[model samples]
Target: MARLLVTPATGALPVTAGGMTLSLTDPGCITSLAPWRGAGMALSKALRAAHGVDFPDPGRISTSGTTRCLWAGRDQAFLVGPAPDSAALADHAALTDQSDAWAVMRLDGPGARDVLARLTPLDLRAQVFEPGHTARTLLGQMNAVLSRDAANGYEIMVFRSMTATALHELTEAMKSVTAQGGADPSPG
Candidate 1:
């Protein structure tokens, strides 16, 4: 007998418009961590020992090798990386398995920022939202975690239940931006 493996069934979604590419991202093993009773220092040290990642400050992200800790909000950080382990954070703080609860995507290439600018309220510019910066913002009607992965790359995470709607809105926005840039219109 063999165990089973099931994915979210989102299939492979990659949209190319002009010089931009929007691709569904595979975020392996996402874990949410929230400290209780102001034990952030203790929790941070524990996480450092477990994943070699320094807990990030608010609006910031800390990455050590493959592991990344994104600031989810005040006193809370989302540990997005490989090798998911509940006990890695359970003792130090509250833990939630968010691996299947999010629909992650990346917008990269030349016109990535232009597409993002059309959908999100936050400034997606280089100086203001540079790499290592993270924020919770509105992506159309859905709440999304927006992170600047690089000057030309950005990551967006929205609730799994809102995946279709979010993708639709993002694709549409990308099309508009790319079309104006004289790139071929995105696929319908």
Candidate 2:
């Protein structure tokens, strides 16, 4: 018998008014583990001992090389790496598979910030929201996390259902900003 391979739909949603593009990836395999159940103070120490790196507190850990860790919550952390061996990490803490529960969307282009600003209250100034930093913020009234992927790109995390709305809002925002610049006849 041939084994059947099922793949989830992964593609870019339609562009909105602002030229903001929302591209979706394979429902990134997520392995959630609770690391602070025991000695909260030593969670980082324990994580380092087990994973070879310190557990980054929310918005602190930087993506160094192949693997990057994000603090998903106070006691929870999400590891972004080559297909995770959740079983290996389960030996130390409770591991939950969240691959299908969340969606990763990449927002890029010049007007990225303007589009995001319209939805989020967080200050996204380059000097403020530098690269490699991540923050859990609301997007268009929906709770989601945004990561600064690059100088002009952001990786947004939102529930599967809100993907459509989020994309729409971002696109509209990007278009509005673009229009403002081009509407000005005089070039500075």
lDDT of 2 by residue, 1-188 (tens): 12211223333463544445657654345557676357444655555555555567777553445566677777777766545554445555676666656677787766677778779999888777878778888998888878887777888887766666776676677777778872222211
The residue-by-residue lDDT of candidate 1 on 1-188, one tens digit each, is 12122234345478777777778877777888888777788889888888888779888998988789999987888888775466766767888778877888888877777777777899766778888899999998789999998877899999888877877887888778777864233321
Which pairs of residues have clashing backbones in candidate 1?
none
lDDT (Cα, 0-100) at 170 in candidate 2: 67
Off by over 4 Å in 2: 1-20, 39-53, 62-64, 182-188
Candidate closest to the true structure, highest lDDT:
1
lDDT of 1 at 181: 69
- The clash count for each model shown is 0, 4
Candidate 2 displacement at residue 47 in angstroms = 5.4
Position 183, candidate 2: lDDT = 24
Query: Which pairs in model 2 have colliding backbones?
Result: 17-175, 18-171, 18-174, 18-175
